[model samples]
Target: MKLATYLDGSRDGQLVVVSRDLSQAHFANGIATRLQQVLDDWAFMAPQLEELSISLNHGRCRHAFAFNPAQCMAPLPRAYGWTVPEDGGRRASDALLGPHAPLRLLADPVPCAARYAVLHGDVPRGIDALSARDAIRLLLLAAESPTHTAFAPVAVSPDELGAAWQNGRVMLPVLAMHNGRREGGTDKPEPGADFGRLLSDLAHPRALRAGSLVGATTAVLVPAMAAGDAVRFEVKDEAGHSIFGAIEQDVVLEGTATE
Candidate 1:
């Protein structure tokens, strides 16, 4: 079942269940009004919301409306912490760090962190004392192409989640960038990794972390950005089932001194 957050003219948009075909939507009016609330209590709320989704598909539920990607927000606008694995220059450029060869911003915020972080969770292994919501959110952005970094929906059962880590094999589909840049174009898309490999890569020490950037990627896409450029990020399916909808603001270099 696909879940999303739509704009209700509020800071935290209202939660809703989107049909598989993306032709319809059912409001989560009674069942946790916010997406984070739903994520916080996903174990108990998902099934209930799924039931409502079934009803909506059958025309039994009320207030079903046409779904629109334009009026959506990131599944989790801000995450507790952020971790971005080293790109190795396979899917991105190494020159993004403006003449700095060593690259000291791994532990700090990068342009991508400020613009794209979408999915959030308790911890790398979900052992944290905080609320347990481990499903990875795919932060979709308005890019020139698809990065294969979007989140694929799956059942969040303990056994299923654990299976993703066993023997370095995962049933989960990891979106990966592929091929090569086509004359100043973005990279292509393909299955990059299973759950085990992705988790391991994300935990790598050389990774970058930000308070707001939440999602994981094999390579950093937004290696660089300027002060005036408005680079937006979002992740949804072909049918527009927004996992993390999109970043609202454009990329702004807040007071980086001119030198």
Candidate 2:
């Protein structure tokens, strides 16, 4: 099932269930209002949302509407914590930007492709890698800027990925575009450090809170983005269907007229 958070002028946006083809959606109104609420009680909430997803995808929903990435926020507007692998296994916390949100920067910043997983529930300390894998609820594509990271339009469940999801890593190329032109991309390969092992290592020190975001950057590199430049990142299945929509943003200088 695919899920998204619609921007509703609140810290936590309204949760919506998106269709498989990324065309339609229905408010997760009665079932749940916020993504964090669903994450907090995933075992209870996820199944209900999944059923709604099926209905929307099959064109059986009565009130489904067009899914708009322009009106989306980060799947979790504000996560309990954001952790990313860096510098020999070091972790850091960062803020998140919504897909299609303008990226404001004071200086030119390199755009990097990223992948992240949203945790379903708290992870217990010293759990094994296999068990850690079970804690992952969904995966997303991301574009990493110096100040903050922006995510794709939706979060996709592992089961929805079919054979593309392999042992906690997505086996797909991360493509990058700069100013509407293809710049560079990372080819499909098994990640050296799968999410399960990363989570397992982190959980050894302390329990990880539910809704925490764990991310990793792909090798795709592009020129530093300047004001008015646009960058986009996406991953596709073998048949060329986008898995998590796309993370597309325009770069604007801080304190400039564009801002």
How does candidate 2 fare on TM-score?
A: 0.93
The alpha-carbon deviation from the true structure for residue 82 of candidate 2, after best TM-score superposition, in angstroms, is: 1.0
lDDT of 1 by residue, 116-206 (tens): 2234332344232122223343232222122112222211222322433333222232222222221122233333333334443444433
Off by over 4 Å in 1: 87-121, 124-190, 200-214, 218-259
Residue pairs in clash, model 2: none
How many pairs in model 2 have backbone atoms within 3 A of each other, for residues 3 or more apart or on separate chains, i.e. clashes? Answer: 0
- Model 2, C-alpha of 171: deviation from truth (Å): 0.6
* Model 2, span 74-130: residue lDDT tens: 898788777765423433444577888888886876555555555557789999989
Give residue 69's lDDT in candidate 2 (0 to 100): 94
Per-residue error (Å), model 1, residue 224: 10
Best by TM-score: 2
How much lDDT does each candidate structure score?
0.41, 0.81
